[model samples]
Target: MTPEPRSGRPRSSSREVLSEAACELFLEQGYDATSVSDITRRAGVSRSSFFNYFAAKSDVLWSGFDEQVNAAARRLRGGEAVDAALTGIGDGLAPDALALAITNADAMGIAGELDRDRAVRQFRLQRELAARFVRDGMPQLAAEVRAGALAAAVLAAVWAWADRTAAERVLRDLLATTIALA
Candidate 1:
């Protein structure tokens, strides 16, 4: 059990603990069954403390996903291809990547209340990718559609693999393919 997150902004350590607790509970009790109270208890924090870090249990489950999205954006700007960037983070970065991400996202012990947030987060990530494509001189409409497709493909692949060696293999393959294209 970890100490509660400070009253102000949530600390990384606390957030990590929350995420771990959420994962454990989600796996043990199933995402649909686990409660915020269960997670807080597992994390050794009070209910209020749990709320301090994450508005809900789902937020705790998907806490680091947004970070991965940002990493993808950075990787794109750094001259690394999309597949290479996905491989660097996990394994596959295409169709397989989306599957892995979905599975991983689902593992976060999400409650019904958090579905809207999850969907919105995904939409926002797609938008980010679309903006990146526009910067690369793609036409606005084409870039938007392509960005959404690319983001969707990557997310789907990630969900399918769900933190497995297959995910790693997919990522490596993507990197290799990207390098070949370059």
Candidate 2:
């Protein structure tokens, strides 16, 4: 007889588990003190499994938001309106790794690193937004300025949403509000 089939979760779930474990460990032991091995152990996965899901421990926290950024890039490339593409990027986003990291940055001893990484992401999005603006006939300097403001507002909206109780989050709406306020 064949062994019973496992009702196992999708392989992708390991990423989530690893992120959760990493965040908990970071909060408990501090970022530098928590190794990839510690996250793997806490996640009940192998080191190889962790590597398969994440290039580095930092990826565990940033991957979700990175995907959103990339998706926005694709939309911009396809010539969607900047406001539509950028604001809608957070639609259907759940409170995932980025949210956890944002809320717990200080507690996890990751405030400095988080800020650095956040700037990288912000600038990356700004570049894409600026390119799209240029494509739509704005001057380079003006495009850069507008993109910088919009990108800052987008990230700020994410921070605001993460800081709030989960029940209060509707990221796209908050994004629209933030962009308008900006």
Candidate 3:
């Protein structure tokens, strides 16, 4: 017999299972209509297990990217050059997950919300990238400008690729082109 959600410790894979279940439900019934209860039921986990993995429903889409960003930030702090740090960021981009989220954005009833979140995330990332560049010896003003343009390009590339099949290649090519242009 399976243990109840709160009755026993969750498996190590609980977070992935919960995220997958939430994405499935979000694609089916729409994000606005799917509750945490519905997700837990689908995953056969307790409601508390949902909270253990994510702070909120929207986090299902962003958590992987957040982890990547955090990791890139740590690398930057280790004194990596701006170009190298951005390459690390590109390496961590989960194109498949991002494409899935974008495809379901309208169905999930989070088109606007996702856009807002993306903008905010990009703004913060750009600022941090610029700071890191300055720390690596670029002038502050040049660093800021370069980071802004690079961030915009990266976001545009990702958004454009989200609708395309074989998005991983597109993302890679776009990032390579952007870095070359920079």
Candidate 4:
């Protein structure tokens, strides 16, 4: 039988390992030069394992937040209040690969990549939020307006929280402050 890895590490941690490896490689060699194979090699996992967690290379920096955004979308659609649903976006978030990339985009040479990927996520949240508001009896245009502002707030709070030094980070508090904008 193949021996299991030790130290209580779970199969799911492969995602985290791949993200860390990708971030380190991006810093070491820049994003365009660091391929998926490079990340898999550095992370000590197979290419298939890398795909198990991320769809593409740029996904290494966006998956965690994307997961949270999806969770928040589910919560909102399930009749959760807007503030509660939006704030929950930060519930389990920690300083992660995306934060590292944001803070060191210049060194990692991923500024353009960050902007392009982030816009996709921001609008996704906006679309989800707008639908939720419409279900809650908001007029169409007002729902869109409110959702747009709240979506921007959610992204801003996430970005600000990520920008903080890890030692001082508190995501829920930041979420609360930003959610107040809506």
Candidate 5:
């Protein structure tokens, strides 16, 4: 017998299960050594199911940012623009799920690449956010750019700090600097 085909809607639970399994393997065996087949076997799902959920393993880390960013944008949409943007970013980063992603060695293995992806994402998000702020009568592109810059900078700072200090301290400093810059 064959399995039924998936429709276009996102399958959150399966994706979440695959992501959790991937993180566990990544933490245990390291990222480079883990394969899609290994992840599929561990998750007790077929290869097709995994592909239906994520384009690639790295995508799991990328998935939640947009939703969180949108949520942040909504929260800050009508408020003091820079303050609102930072608040959104800070809130986005504070979730425990993010901690799990970062702590995994396989996830960390993708860090350099992910950082680049993040910077690009930040730039795109900033451009959209700047437009939103402007439409709401905010006049400062520089401030908005600064807020976005600080957001990306905070992540880089946290990566560096994580090497020498605790994750909490790194996060605290990142939040402080991001907020201060905005």
Candidate 6:
């Protein structure tokens, strides 16, 4: 077990451990076959501890990205330019976690199962981003279009990163380019 940080909360290492353990189990036993108990047992953590960090098994794969998205949304709401906001979001990508999931997607049986959930989350993110842009003085339709494009770009970049074809490309750069085109 990791020691608690100064704030008396377990260090972020606990989350990492859970995520790593979940991914390994997903890859080995298949995502459908792995339960929260299995992940907790592998991580040597309590069930409550797992709940403290993740709402569901799939969350182990997306929580980091979701955190980044929320941060970017906050920046957007703070009047940051769309490009800069998207760049911030890209900058938040957890390379190691994402790479692990992408590389083991097939083995984990997550490739097809993720689309619907991902699409829903992406749409919600797009709406929130668009709303922020509108509050920042952009026209509604324009904000919506820009948000949609930026959201799509983020998805594309994740896919590219996972595919390992963008080995030399930085996520922020991809986001910047996509925003520029938008």
Estimated TM-score for each candidate: 0.62, 0.90, 0.80, 0.91, 0.63, 0.86
Show model 6 residue runs off by greater than 4 Å.
Answer: 1-9, 137-139, 165-167
Candidate 3 lDDT for residue 72: 68
Candidate scoring better on lDDT of 3 and 5: 3
Per-residue alpha-carbon lDDT of candidate 1 for residues 1-182, written as tens digits (9 for 90 to 100): 99976574346677777777777776677777888888888888788988877776667645555566677668877767655665565421343222333455555444343446656665776787677678878899998887666655654444444446443456545434433433
Q: Tens digits of per-residue lDDT for model 3 on 9-72?
A: 4577776777788888888888788999998888888998888878877777777667777776
How many residue pairs clash per model? 26, 0, 0, 0, 0, 0
User: Residue 89: error of model 6 in Å?
Assistant: 1.6
Candidates by TM-score, descending order? 4, 2, 6, 3, 5, 1
Best by TM-score: 4
Q: What local lDDT does model 2 show for residue 120?
A: 90
Query: Please, what are the lDDT tens digits per residue for candidate 6 over residues 7-72?
Result: 533657888998889888988899899999999999988899899998888888888888888898
Instruction: Kindly report the root-mean-square deviation of model 1 from the true structure over all alpha carbons.
Output: 6.7
> Compared to the true structure, candidate 2 yields what TM-score?
0.90
Better of 2 and 6 by lDDT: 2
Poorly placed runs, candidate 2 (over 4 Å)? 1-9
- Model 3, residue pairs in steric clash: none
- The ten-residue window of minimal lDDT in model 1 covers 91-100
For residues 46-137, write the lDDT of model 4, one tens digit per residue: 89888888888999999888989899889888888888888888888778999999889999999999989888888999899889888888
What lDDT score goes with residue 109 in model 4?
A: 97
Give the per-residue lDDT of model 5 (tens digit) for 1-182.
Answer: 99998763256677777777887777777666778988888887888988886787766655665566666667566554555455455453433334565554354465565566667667766766666666766688665865467556545544544444334453545656656754
